[model samples]
Target: MSEFSELRYLCGSLVAVLLASILLTRGWRSKHRHLPGPPPKFLVGNLKDLPTGGHEWDQYAKMSELYGSDVLYMTALGTGLLVINSFEAAHDLLDKRGSVYSDRPRLVMIKELMKWDWNLILMSYGKNFTTYRRVVQQEFQPSTVAELYRPIMATEVIALLDRLLRSPEDLIQHFRLMAGAIIMMVTYGHKVDSVDDKYVALAEAVREYSAQRPGTELVDVFPILKYLPSWFPGAGFQKYAAIGKKLSIQMRSAPFKMIKDRLASGTASPSLASRLLHQSVDTGGIDQDQFAQNTCAVVYSAGADTTLAAMINFILAMTLYPEVQERAQRELDDVVGRDRLPNFSDKGRLPYVSNVVKETLRWKAVAPLGVPHATVSDDVYRDGYVPKGTTVIANISAMLHDPSVYSDPDTFSPDRFSPTDQKSEGEPDPARAAFGFGRRICPGRFFAEDSLWLAVASLLHVFAITNPDGRGGNGVKGIRWSSGLVSLPSPFPYKLEPRFSKAPELVSAAERT
Candidate 1:
């Protein structure tokens, strides 16, 4: 045989061998696929079932209703997906077997260029993650968080009230400013003076880039797309990375510089970043890149947006159910009084108000699918095999609205969380699941909860938020939601009138405090 023909024959044999190896691996996996799931199409798998844009979770809800809790499948790109649609299932996997299910799936765009592998929200479960989590835990200890941040939170809440009083029509911007100011103060020890401040602008820019879009980056689904060169036009991943780099620099360097300047001048306020920087200088255990990048990523992405989304939902809930709002306001009035704005100290006394916050989180979890978790080892769940490296999603939306756990899961009733209601019944309160379960749960949860509680209590006490009468006006009548990974109440017209006639006196009192 000619040399060319011999080479062709050899290539064909190698290709066939590679194909056989792949088939053998898949066949092995198929044997243990005991979980009931829709049959996958050849090559595409169950990609067709995955929804895009705002409808993703909505579609997942419908599927859960049809297929039951444990829905397992292989995506078009050969990625294993397990969507846990029940609280019990999520608890069993994310909490009970956290060791094998705590890591995040490989995010090519975030991992490669952005160097986000060490971010607490994205990092895999390991010693490095443990170290970072430890630092965060120390920074956000309940006592320290309340003590160090109560004054700042109070100031921001007052400012939010002021903004609302001046222009009661712009509730969306008011909510954004309130959330952004608190997060900014917590992260940088600097207050956001106005919604248009430089820091607010930066936060909004970061949110815009991180907002998920339909088929935004093919790389998220097709891992091989990361292999494409940056020069390739129409490669959305490259643009995303570039945007992330710009955001990373602005987010990291700006705060680090602030800390450095403050330390040089010996005028730094006590903050998580300041403390971490000081500790880094002494121990030299944490890498500078990891420290800066991870800190900024936390504050910028997870800190601001998640808190803002929750706050927005709280406002939306109040607007939808005015009776709930009135009860919360009455609770605040009895405990906090109009003489002073609500503070963290009033938390225990204001149980009903706290219940409202919990209900808001459950009603619309900020990130419906609580950040996709990756399997670190092969997981055996009720005779079904979840192969190592499979992408597992804790469908937080479904879990929050689980019919078995929560009665009338679709309703927006805060009574389910009232202390007496749970004690009266022999059942555990539903608010326990709102913060999430297990190792990967949000670390800033305490901070977020406090911010929302103070803001909600203060807002309810000071102003009456109502759906704007649009009979002859342009105000939004029926509220709608915006589409994104973080589902926030879409911008709607709402009137924010002072509850009492003595508005000026209330403003004066707030200013005095």
Candidate 2:
């Protein structure tokens, strides 16, 4: 035979052998073939089954309903993804199996190329994550947040009330500004004078960039592709990541540098950074390192943006159900008189207002599909095989909107949680599921809850939020729920008026100092 013909024959044999090996391996590993889920396309798996638009979480809830299982398993381009659509399943896997399930899946775009891997929110479960979490949670845990940060948070919200009173048209911006400024003060002891302030602007840019990211990019599904040069075809995500990396570094370094300077000069106000950085005399004068700095930056992305979203949802809820608003305000007024704004001390007496906060989360959680958790080893439950590397999600929206759990899942009724309100036997309360379940739950949950409660209770006490167009009475909801990781009530026109004639003087007299 000619040499050319012999070479062709050899190449064909190698290709056939490679194909057979792949087929054999997959057939041998098809233990989950019996697990029910959406039918995947040939070889492509469930790539086409992925949600396409802003309501990805909504689509996931629907998938769970159609499939009749809280845990729905699927694949995309060979990647295993389990769409968890129940609180019980979420708690079982992410909580009960915390030791084996707390690790985060590697999202190349956000964590690697974007350089956000340093943030504690996306850190892997290990010694590094454990140490960083310990530092960040010291100030934000339930006890410290109320004792050390409430006064500053209240002052920031009062400034928000002042802004809303002056420019009622800018309600959404006012909400964002309030959330950002509160975190800024608590993290860096920096006061944001205006929404346009430089640091605030950087944080705003970073927030916007983070929100625009896709749930999962192609590079994430195929990690090898991340190594491709930016000039390569379909490498646009890399360039996008470069832009994010720049913003992230600037966001962390700028404020950290300022704090260090002020601390050295003895001009810095009390802050998490100041306290965490104070040369741990016990540890022989330790210095604040990159770990702490990145965690502090996480305050803006994970903490500020999420609380802002919840507060925005609260306003939308009040606009849709004016009666709910009236009930919350009545409770606030009864417990804390109009002589001053609601304070941390008053939270204990304001049961209805607290219930309102819980209802807002249940109505439409800020991030409907809480952050994804990954499995560290292959496991089986209920005769189902869950392989390692599966992206496990906690479908909080499903838990919140389940008819069996909530009396009227779609309706905004804070009374569902009121102590005095009678609930049917066996009804499930979804309050704990709101923050998340288990080991990877949000560490800043305490601060977010308190910040949201203070904003909602204080605003309801002073202002009656309603739809100015009067369409709410016709049962037309005005606001759209967000589809992003950090979901906020989409911008909608609403009227904010003083609940009482004395609101202006009350707001002005309240402390902003």
Candidate 3:
């Protein structure tokens, strides 16, 4: 038989075996069987109910609404999946009971097949994970970001503005280069001027492959499939996994080796990698070199894609809300003035610009479903209970878009956050749910926000971004949102026009300094 035919035969045989085994074990029961969710099928469980297209976060939110509970439970192929769809439930569970929910699910595709075990974000909760968090947190705290990384952030924004002005059509590429540049510089003291840079390509490739999750892939739900030989019928995942493993290793080791070589020659530029390497110590049964390498790789991969996605969403929002853009520009012109670009010193004075940044994060969360958290022990909440090892997901997009939390939640209104005479408290900050919750929150959040603030402020100050096809200020009609670990608007045509007569001069001057 042909390879394709053989593959089909193998898949059919596997399913038959699975069905027979399931029938034999039908006597088994689930402790979470009473939890709120759609009923499972005889063999597929909730497999057919899982989202195949569109945003998973949105589907999960609808499920939460249909069940009339913020916490949801479902099973696919006998694996338990728990989704926390509201901020309150997420806080009550993932935050208040973090000791039980901080661990990550055994992402078979991400860890076993792709060999991304070094990823601190997906690593199980333990001493190694704690140390990795501490290492990254030390470098990205607000004070440290302000004191040390603001210059790098500002420099990148200026470069981005220059690129946007020259080739406005490649808006997404410019954002990618800008985000990659800032991350490469901060994490490894390496410079990236183009999206085609080898390091940038490597990071992007790894991010794309790593998007696979447990429920999405049969191999992830049944990890024993990982042992299948690459030449085996229906084992294409094994071959794909090999590519991911190669990229993962290169992503972690290449730039790190350069830094180490430079350090040996006493020529290493000060960077997170070099700094951590200098302070490397074998402690808690962890190898310091491996620890630093893993930390730096995770920082680079995580920071680059997320910032790029957020920037794209910011541009999409501007294209769809010209009035909001105009208002932000007015604030920028009034505060920072058109004579020059924005700087960290003016951040406090630019309240409206700050709110615009906050609205961008809330309007479209980059990671719609924040990294999945796993339960290490059985947990009870309200009338339901989550068994140990349940793959817990916080629907971050739902929380940020909760209508009760923010009136007219779909509207992109920066003023929602501004305190008024009648409502002095204003709306709750989306940052609480935007960055994440509990111990698994993004450590680089402060740095990410700082970079985003400068980029948004500078872009608004220099250019008028609008849709080229005259879809200005219209709702997202032609635009489609991508669904993945990080979600953002797909590429759409947008025009960039200089707001000030001296826009080019301003970008040039900023670059010179």
Candidate 4:
């Protein structure tokens, strides 16, 4: 009997071991195992492999090359990260199959801690997002921009030219002010007179303090940290979060409240907020007035930052590549003439200038790694399994800089886009990748592009951007770019002078009218 009991116990132990082995194998399986990427380690799972320091976009690009695939997969702990390197791959997943990939990864730092849930750039995909996009799209559609926003852009560009002539040394500040001015007027009809404009200051302060590592904060990974008290160990971010919350509320509400009060008094100027407020009737139980405020606030914050970054890039490219600047100026002079600053009507006539704007966008992407998009459900792409909740990052910088797509991509050459150029025949337009992909493509892109063109054309038509030492064609060497969601050139020494004797007078003339 004892021998029989021992045999039974042995059989039971064998079955238990087999069951455990099967479960362990299943648990260890990765849905993205078919995708190429750095080998993940046990437990840590590629934590050390994540890019660090600035120009992470470059690092990811290199990783894509090393992995020998456009879709590069990685993981931290148990979370998956999908980096799309090529335009084809990004377009395929983020654009063509947008419904499955349009959702955004939850950002605990920005949404919960900073209280910026209303920000359209980071808002998740859902009914609220749809409502916000509808409200914003109506304001920034091409027709609306042409009818209402173009004059605003032309006016601001002229003001920028005047500001550059007077305070050329404060180049970055001037760009910031110009961007703020355009956005303020377009969104709330708020006139920004100077760098000290209260609305600009409030919005800027919130952006600066609340900026986080593109959704990679520790609190973002482990949202439970948001519960920690400000005084607790490693809870310093909580205090800043508190400050950000207050500033965010004021920034989102102050200008909107002013517009609302003006409308009530029958004095509200025609602005996006005011117009939306006038037409705002309750939509599906959501507050229309609040919706208007949210959409306008989003436009103000997002539009200003991207516009300023692009302008800065155009300046950097001109300073570094004087030949490109000269060609653009020649185009402007030939098409728009020197008597008046360039306007929207000259856009089609000045293709080279348009290409210069395109090249600037390609050379240095604004939002290099676009705001992260999240997978709403498990799906397969290119024979690879993409698990739900994966953080999908469309590497815009990588797509724009792919040498296969743009030969000698690192060199700032606007001619690469010219159909007449011998080297290439009208390479793919960078705007497709520069702005973003699919459902999340910038709704305000029409106005944004118009704003960039007007600024670039006017600046080139008026000023000769060169090295600070006044040496023509001598470029700022060893240029470094800031690393974040938005990339811009680090402050470099530059000089702005009237391209011709009549340039300053033309700018003054335009500003006066």
Best by lDDT: 3
Instruction: After the best TM-score superposition of candidate 4, give how far the Cα of residue 395 lies from its true spot, in angstroms.
Output: 0.9
* Tens digits of lDDT, candidate 1, 1-513: 664465456445644564465466774236565466667765446768776656466678787676764565555445788887777788888899989988888777776665666567878778877777776766777787788877788888888888778887777777778777877777767767887787678768766766543233556644455665666544545766877777866866666677678778988777667766665532237775457446644765777777778877776666667788888888877887767666777888988887787788888878777688889998788878888888887677777777767778767787886445446652345445555668877777777777778887787888887766432233224445555546666665456788877654776687875
Instruction: List clashing residue pairs in candidate 4.
Output: none
In candidate 1, how many Å is residue 312 off?
Answer: 1.5
Instruction: Name the best candidate (by TM-score).
Output: 3
What's model 2's lDDT at 231?
73
What lDDT score is found at residue 39 in candidate 1?
Answer: 72
Alpha-carbon RMSD, candidate 3: 2.2
Q: Pick the winner on TM-score between candidates 3 and 4.
A: 3
Instruction: State the lDDT of candidate 3 residue by residue for 347-447, as single tens digits.
Output: 89999889999999999899999988999998787877777888888999999999888889888899999888867978888899998889999998999
Where model 1 places Cα greater than 4 Å from the true spot, the runs are 1-29, 212-216, 280-284, 288-293, 419-431, 470-484
In model 1, which residue pairs have backbone atoms overlapping below 3 Å?
A: 44-76
State the C-alpha lDDT per candidate: 0.70, 0.78, 0.84, 0.83
- The residue pairs in collision within model 2 are none
Model 3 spans with C-alpha error above 4 angstroms = 1-33, 208-215, 280-283, 471-473
Report the poorest 10 consecutive residues by lDDT, candidate 2.
279-288
lDDT of 4 by residue, 306-343 (tens): 98899988887888788788888888888888788888
What's the TM-score of each model vs. the native? 0.88, 0.91, 0.94, 0.92
